[model samples]
Target: MLERQSTVGSAPIGSFVALGDSFTEGLGDEAPDGALLGWADRLADLLARRSPVPFRYANLAVRGRLIDEILEEQVPQVAELTPDLVSFCAGGNDILRLGSSVDRIAERFEEAVVELSSHAKTVLVFTGFDPRGTPVLRRLRGKIATYTAHIHAIADRHGCLVVDLWSMKALQHPRAWSDDRLHLSSEGHRQVALRAAGVLGLRPTRSAPATHALQGRVRQPQRLDDLRWAKEHFLPWLGQHLLGRASDEVLEPKRPQLLPL
Candidate 1:
């Protein structure tokens, strides 16, 4: 169980900008209007409550974005928004591809970090969550671990805070992820928000929820679920790559501008 039992304290964040791909965009954590309200938004709400001045936020995350793309497209926006805080969680999509090099990805990631550190007062980065408990993603756990180590080293070198998702125990549970086993769920997003707030030295206004929940054994056949996931989620994603079409190519960022909450 996690514990966060304090109102928005004296943490001095005023504006924040989030950059990366689906996770930062809140893909699995859908809102009522069919929009995703992922962790960055949750953390922004917390910051808004804690800060003495008006807090503004922008999320430039688009689904299926690569780290290089973020560096090329998103990082430049930091100079304009000039938010006091910036969160960078990328390279997962890059890692998922075949022939992807962890070292190369981390190098590009660090480049963005260097640029971000110069622009924002507080630069925040997230390590990839542990995937050992996941069947499909576990094979890439080694790569994830390697990248995470680089993330920590980069954070240390650049004087940035980290939201070490690799160590979050609660995310191991099924509920923390969506059906695809890639993105985090709503509760997972909440957990991430709580962790990010802690990293920024902010206090939550409420208690933290238990990391694990009791999800009774499923009666449905496992093979059926796997087939469905492959058909509904995996195939289309793979098809996009085969056709050289990026999912977010036509879509604009969910929150393009930094605005008051």
Candidate 2:
């Protein structure tokens, strides 16, 4: 498929806007000030180092957002913000639900990419994480794959860069996940940032730590860990599901405005 003419080389990616749920918001990876410093932020750092111009970044992602919420709240802002680049990854939350339709979610996703493609100089989209790493989430792998296919088709149609998370083998390790088993660990995020940079046709500088995934394969896990994860993490998440509550329903965005890095 023909890639849209990217501003990656012709011009600097001075501005980036991130939209999605907790993953894009940098959950599981906390900073000293108690804010998320996820892959998007790390990608911004990588971009800033490469570009001659100053970079601005905004993350409008909250923890429990579905694709519809992202469409209503985030997609409309793309034109107004007019970012040089926009990273969008949503619908994972919807995929996790009991009776969710992947087709319906894909339609919403396509709508978002269409809007994003219209306004941003460069638009990047992500596939769902490979669930094999976390035993608890592994049951939904088939659904995730179906949704991931839709994501790829949407990216192809819109000429957006695609980050195929499901194909990242390093993520299949236990260490790559957080205690919650849902979000990526700090090490995992680092690896993902490197992958994102590679997709944008950029290389990591010597100063930046190399992705662990690049070196080799990681070790396997113990069966006992699964039981412990179920007790400590999965049960609470199940409770939240039963109660119809969101992780960050009332919490304002950590980074609402596009500020210089």
Candidate 3:
């Protein structure tokens, strides 16, 4: 967790803008303020409680958003906000749409970051959890990992923060998923919120129950013996230790092209 000390009266006061897709929109069996209870609202609530001044939140998340769409419309909106803090959650749709090279995703993300950094002091970017273990939507883990790495490298180059959400408890076990399997359940969302709170230096508030009953019935438990070992071991370790911190190695020479893989 990042250490944040309140400097008497120095907490910057400004609006917070969240730009992303369904995760940001909180699409599931939950609702807050007549809308899906997404992470951005959760983050904003946490920040308001922790900071010295109250800040407003602006959510610009639309469901089914791809990287190209984000770059086209959302990026410019975020750039215009000039917010004190900005949270970006993208790339899942990219993996879904174009399972191409990592370099390609990196280029798109880098452009988004360049525009974001020019306006905000701190930007929080999310790398999604491993999706290979899912029963229905399995087999895309490699592509997702490639896209995640691209985003990570871009965040590294720009000195932004990342939340390695891909490494949490859900990927290994069958119980972590909601009925839909793609989106997180209310509890799943809460767990994610807790981890995100740890990253953002804020506290999480319990989400309200959905106005409508949650769809998708949970499936019977199946053993995860067929899943890859790296899904169980390496990804979680990276998320806990490396994702949000600066590189530890001392360098005689500094070059972005030679960055660690």
Candidate 4:
């Protein structure tokens, strides 16, 4: 875990904005209303509880966004909000690309962080988690580690607080992940929200139900199950890359404006 900076003390936050791709957008953390209620939302709820005054929040994230796309589309909007705090988690999609350059992605990501940091009182960044149990994603663990290192370096240089997802052992469990094996399940998002609250020096007012109780025994995936996932998710992802397309090509930001929560 990165040390909490003195810049953002254990005080109540006024406003917050979240920026990134699917993870930040809360892809696998679906609600009964068919809406995404990701970690960002849960974190915002925690912030709201900690604050005595009105708390405003916004989430400017979309699925399948690359580092550059986040820089180009979300940064300006988030900068305009000038929230008390901002959490950024991007570049995972970029790292998954075949010929993506880790160095370039880091450079662009740092630029976005720098820009957002100037506007917000504090900026929070995240390191990607190791997808060890997932079949195909496990193979890209090396690349994920490399990108996570770059993220740490960038956060250090900019004096940003980091939520070190890479070091979280709880996420290594298969139950923490969704069927897609890429995004976190609702329980996983809740755990992340609790950790984020801890980083911000706040105790969660409410606790999320334990994942073990909600998710029963998780058996090792069968060979056929792996093949089915490859056909359904991996192959389509590859096709999108080959065609220079993204899943969120026609999608809009989940929360475009800062509003009271």
Candidate 5:
């Protein structure tokens, strides 16, 4: 059994298990406890706000995790947690380390999802940025369409939800990412959390009181058709307008024509 550390005891009985890598570990920003507040943490914070039941989250992610490694190490421990909502954000390291092959990576990913479905109510699979927008993070988004397609199919087969971060990312400008060209900033985290809430059918706001809160936030809600546009077009344009060229200076390509060009 994988021993639980950093257990949020104040959290409700309900549990969420995150199985993935550094992104899941929140590698960039620091948390109150001195850990990085990755997307999972932000999502957890957002979900806690809207959860009707008390929520306990177990972030079972380590740095530099690969697909095969995750299958061997993380899968077994999932059965023990028996989470209500399961999130899996992997494949970055695998793609980075093992070389990008659509078939090989998808095979391992499919197997992981198949195993994970049996142990949870809904498995939310998280992925990285969209390649179309971020030219620098080629490793992160290479063969992304093919990869996400397989993931979409796998989620469909198992009745799980694939949170398409890639698609979300395509809609976003390059500036949303941090200096490392990988992880999200605080605003980026909030944007992702809001989208996650939309996916789970919860409101984007903080934890609210029971009565005044809206019901059926997720259950039978309309799917957000243009989340990519919302992120890419709306957010960036807004960012440009509000923050001025500074936002463009931060997010937009700084040196489009450089070097030997």
Candidate 6:
């Protein structure tokens, strides 16, 4: 088991900045207002409520961002913000791609973590979950495992807190995932936010219910369900990769500037 940092519970966070791709961008956790409410946002809300002072937050995560893209584009900006806390979850998009090198990705990922840790009082990193539950993403399970191991090592070396998504049994359920089979569902995001808060030793304003109870009985995907998913999400994603495009190429950051929640 990874040890929690002593500093995690030592102080209240005054500011927070999140960095990463679709998972961090809150894809499946859509708000009633049509905004994405990923785990990072939820965590920020929790921190805001617990904080004795005003809390400022910014989320620079854009979907489909690669590790290098986050390092080059978001890291400098995040460092400038100099927030008290930073949550970074990237490189899953790179590992899911064909012919990607886990070692090379890890090197870049570690570099970014080191840089971010230097700027922020606390840096949070996440391990990629096992994709074996998703039909299409199942093939990348081995790669995801390898990448997740690297993440653990990197986070340890930098003294950063790690949220081990790989071992979250509740996330293995199909219902915890979105129709895309890549991102987490709204409930999944909520559970993650709760887990993150626990790591940081912060009590949320509202209680988070058990993830397994919310999911109920696990149902296997039918043939029609798989076909529908492939037609609706997988094929378009494949075409985008083939053409060297990304879903977030034209999308903007949900919260570009830091503001009080």
Backbone clashes, each candidate: 0, 0, 2, 0, 7, 0
RMSD of 6: 3.6
Report the C-alpha lDDT of model 4 over 1-261, residue by residue, as the tens digit.
222321257555889999999899998999999999999999887777667668899999988788888888999987579899899999888888888888888889899988998998889999988877678878889888998999999989999989999987668777787887778988789888878877777653454457345345556788999999999887887778535765555888888899998
Q: lDDT of candidate 2?
A: 0.82
Q: State the displacement of the C-alpha of residue 230, model 3, in Å, after optimal TM-score superposition.
A: 25
lDDT of 5 by residue, 78-195 (tens): 8876877778877775554434587788888888888888987778886556755443334445477677778888778877766777766322643445644456665566566556
Best by lDDT: 6
Cα RMSD, each candidate: 3.4, 3.9, 13.8, 3.7, 14.4, 3.6
Question: What is candidate 4's TM-score against the reference?
Answer: 0.89
Let me know the TM-score candidate 1 reaches against the reference structure: 0.88
Q: How high is each candidate's TM-score?
A: 0.88, 0.90, 0.71, 0.89, 0.68, 0.91
**Candidate 4 residue-wise lDDT at 132:** 72
| Candidate 5 clashing pairs, residues 3+ apart or interchain | 12-54, 26-38, 49-207, 171-232, 175-251, 201-217, 201-218
lDDT (0 to 1) per candidate: 0.82, 0.82, 0.62, 0.83, 0.60, 0.83
**Candidate 1 wrongly placed segments (more than 4 Å):** 1-11, 204-207, 212-224, 241-243, 247-249
Compare candidates 1 and 5 on TM-score and give the better one. 1
Candidate order, lDDT descending: 6, 4, 1, 2, 3, 5
lDDT of 3: 0.62
lDDT tens per residue, model 3, 46-156:
566555655667777766666777788687876566777777887676565433555676688888888999987778788867776564345777777777777778888
Q: Per-residue lDDT tens digits of candidate 2, residues 40-103?
A: 8888777776666777888888777878989998888788989999999999988888889999
Give the higher-TM-score candidate: 2 or 4. 2
RMSD in Å for model 5: 14.4
Q: What is the Cα-based lDDT of residue 137 in candidate 3?
A: 42
